[model samples]
Target: MNPDMSAGSHNGISMVAEGGYQVAILPADGKQLTLYPSLQIDRAYYWTFEAKADNPGDKIYTSLWGDRGAKTIPLTSEWQQYSSMGTPNPNYQYFYFWSVAAKGNVYLRNIKLYDAQDLDIVVEKEWR
Candidate 1:
């Protein structure tokens, strides 16, 4: 977490009993949580994760490689899986999830970035 963007006592990340983590980003203007993952240039990958907000209709903004790939994801109160596929921009190396004008806690689990070619094998193993 960046000190400048920190929400003081209003934001936190904690481990959940079942699995994964709970990330709380309180309602505020310009508060963002960023995650940087090592990615191979020019490789197509599948980005997948399960997430749910504390309340129905909460929204989260996600950006890949700065603003080159941006998406507005609407979240529900119940856990749901989200996924996207693309090659990372060679110029930037970042993935971000932020609260621009929304509030509430968001639970995230099984966050994965897998090679597009290997995704089927990974999914098969998970189902077995």
Candidate 2:
């Protein structure tokens, strides 16, 4: 994934997802984009991001994994802010944002994660 430094994004960089993936699986090595201060058990956390697709129908979504598995949230094609809040499983570990399919492109920026009390947590944008 190449970050588009010229996108003039809210953050220092914008993710440029060239192609889509059916599933953003966790790597065997275990390193993934983890939310700092590991979400507390039975507490709600808010997740947000800015995204835009290259084509009108192109899209993206995120899958959040916890003890059981995860849930998905769809994103729009145009540049806009998106968010979700929920009490994740006690074993919540990592989350992944993936394109719809093995086609199209999408750009994402200004990703943020916060707890129920509206406190911003450190989210390291690491890729696997």
Candidate 3:
């Protein structure tokens, strides 16, 4: 597994948590995925972060930060799944995770990236 996924600057953010935190598989450096072309005003795109909560009964959520603003997608306590999508601008370049019930530990399986329209899947990139 890679340290960083296809994300942007984690400036004050992190992937580590004691009893309750973002619970992400963060990068050694704050900077994660930096798209080549960046985002456009109207170009639609989608990003996905897949994981299984250590406690299947725990609640988790997905968050994204872009030029527009911050968006949060809710998650269930089931051992199933979660995802989100949008047409973000190129200006913003950071994402955050929210834990509804992050009491114990959580394991992030994979954080993926992709094209918006066809939804082509892109593997999570390392911070190198």
Candidate 2's C-alpha runs over 4 A off are 1-37, 66-77, 119-128
lDDT (tens digit, per residue) of candidate 2 on 32-85: 333333556665666666666555555454545542223333435566776555
- 1-128 in candidate 1: lDDT tens per residue? 12212222233444444643443443434455555676677776666666677777777665566564466677888878776556677887656566545567665555566667765553321210
TM-scores, all candidates, are: 0.65, 0.53, 0.49
Please list all clashing residue pairs in model 2, or write none if there are none.
none
25-125: candidate 3 lDDT, tens digit per residue: 42323223233334455655556555554444544444345533233333333334445555564565444454554554444444554456664663333
**On a 0 to 1 TM-score scale, where does candidate 3 land against the true structure?**
0.49
Candidate order by decreasing TM-score = 1, 2, 3
Candidate 3, lDDT over the whole model:
0.44
Full-model lDDT, candidate 1: 0.57
Q: What is the overall TM-score of model 1 with all chains considered together? A: 0.65
